[model samples]
Target: MTVKENFELAKKAYEKWDIDIDHVFAQLKQVPISIHCWQGDDIGGFEVNQSELSGGIEVTGDYPGKATTPEELRQDIEKALSLIPGKHRINLHAIYAETDGIAVERDELEPKHFEKWVQWAKKNGLGLDFNPTLFSHEKASSGLTLSHPDKEIRQFWIDHCIASRKIGEYFGKELGTPCLTNIWIPDGYKDTPSDRLTPRRRLKESLDEIYTVKLDEKFNIDAVESKVFGIGSESYVVGSHEFYYGYALKNDKLCLLDTGHYHPTEMVSNKISSMLLYSEKLALHVSRPVRWDSDHVVTLDDELKELALEIVRNDALNRVIIGLDFFDASINRVAAWTIGTRNMIKALMLGMLMPNEHLKQLQEDGNFTERLALLEEFKTYPFGAIWDYYCETMGVPERENWLNDVKQYEKEVLSHRE
Candidate 1:
């Protein structure tokens, strides 16, 4: 049968469960996932005097056609977004600012540095998000930033973060959407440290100072991220989940939950409901972690489906902010973005097609057998047909057709990057 015929059948089948396939498609299209800009350059931003990636971050492989300048990166981003379905946002790091060949110290950065990005985003009809680059800097080489023992070094990072908030506000104001400014510091010790309390106290004080001047929430929202541990911070990471969770609650800020920032056995899907109870809003950095905090490209894995289900089931789609956070330099950079983003959209569509209310009713009525059976039955549903229809309606390639476009772009554009 043709694609439309299959979709019609699937739509009728879903109607038996009182599910509106059209409504699901409309809702899914409106949910925007912020694609990270670092994937194009493997986290190497165009900053003067920028050193090699440090502070427990590492990007493996030597992929050719990696973006080297702001223009190249933006071009690559445009190509990737073309292949992915639906409207999306771009997530930028502080280091990605266009400074016009001049050196701008991190703490001295201003919104003018990113005026070009604002203009580009405006032209492309994309929203923008911001992150303070807290690693790979001279002051961060010691594996400490906001929690650094040296007062001068700590203050430098604090000022940088404050500046980042203002830049985020600028983007939001220009784009007419709130920009989520997330702060993630790679501050911890490689070995056991007897003075953990001191660093934690310093970090708390530093955060307080950085957030002293609150920007308008309509334009900017603050989010603090926590990591279980990183490469050099295996012993103790100062921004543990507990620390940021408490800080976010007390300070009225959003807490960002990075999937790869927790233990392997811990699924971020389980933490969603609990966090929503206390947080007015929650931010997500969705990535796949093989075993450790390795930022592997995302796929339509079980965890991803579960995460999407949690959001849809709890009716918290508006309360959660979604963003991609993976960097794989092994393959085509543009394809990596396309694959991860398309998979994310696919997962959300699957979640939306689920009969969540019916499942809840079964569980509440102690009908465990029917609930388990229906869950298994859903595995064989015609979700692919619905996904293809959505893609076709959104004016993107239905399936592997996008791969051909990425390959052609690599030959035409990315191949000449050197």
Candidate 2:
């Protein structure tokens, strides 16, 4: 299969999906979903991270345990790849900071370590891409100390972050250019209220420095992972308006949005609409809800689930990279991970099936509210029914000669890209 052939094969599957949505919905009821990452590391040949996935298991996002070694992870990926049929892939939730002496598997931010866990992509036939994580790649600092508000301490924090930036650079240079190097900082403080607008100001200062002196293309996937909180007195970006920080920074960098970080009072769709208002600043990091915590998966909630799909309906979905941000140590890793991936795909497929009239309404509308209201009307429709129908009816199973087919497809796609 050529790249075109592979894509065509996928399109055929999707078209069948479009035609048999009702059938798909019925099948969903009949079939038990077989997802990746279940309880026990080796139960289903999953790479489990027990410490990382500690939480209530059945639903919330959590890791199970160390399922496999790099080799094992690769084998499982191949096995799973053999199962998946041209599905769009996102990432697993938060990858932790490394250990003390591991050989910084990826040498970008060396004196660091690399987990074989992330290596699954290489062996399993997947390509790496970007997801929102990093905000400012500054050097180390205590970050806005007033008593010691001297430039020295603040510089420390900036340098600390910049070290991470070095790691990012290393990734691009050494790791075949990571999909994107993401960062989220714990710099926001709240005790004395140093200032409301400092985080962005400091971030901008750091990024400008990296661009001029450190790396060239501004981190390629430069992004800000924001949250509304404080440690000593520094208030973070409190609302969508503060997104100006991202806009100010965004010639090439992205202002990524985290669904889990949104205030509980806010509607998920409203936040989606709000981000579109600042579309230049808004990149995406996706997950579902476990009450208050970010579950890092597609779930039963109609709002987030529907909102996740809505981005595709408006054609803005691709403006960002997607990743599930869940982490629990007790859950079955494969099952949970698969749920997130499967449902994320499902939600995305939903928004794509919106009517032409609806798309036109959104595209042509002068008023944001009206366009949103129009899109809001079909919340109940099985937007993904068509896609589900296609996959379920056709089956997610690999064809008998799938290895050869995938080899041919990979060869063609790689050839075209290079």
Best by lDDT: 1
lDDT of 1 by residue, 1-418 (tens): 8778989998887889989998998899899999999999999999978889998988998878999999899999999988888899999999998888899999999999999999999999999999999998988989999998899999999999999999999999999999999999999988898988889999999999999987999999999999999999999999999999999999999999999999999999999999898787899999999999899999999999999999998999899999999999999999999999999999898899889999999999999999999999999998888888888888888878899999999899888888
The lDDT per prediction is 0.93, 0.43
Taking all chains together, the TM-score of candidate 2 against the true structure is: 0.59
User: How do the residues 1-418 of candidate 2 rate in per-residue lDDT, one tens digit apiece?
Assistant: 4433444444544454253434334423332221323221322222122233211122333332333443434333444444343433323212233454342211133323334433544444343333222221222134332112355644543454455555555444444434344445544444545565655555556546544534544333555555554232234433233553454356455665566665656555665655666554345556554455344445646765566555654555445455555543354333344445456556655555445344565668666786677567656443433443345344552222334543453344322331
What is the Cα root-mean-square deviation between model 2 and the actual structure?
A: 10.7
**Residue 238 lDDT in model 1?**
98
**Poorest 10 consecutive residues by lDDT, candidate 2:** 47-56
| Alpha-carbon shift of residue 52 in model 2 (angstroms) | 11
Q: Pick the candidate with the highest TM-score.
A: 1
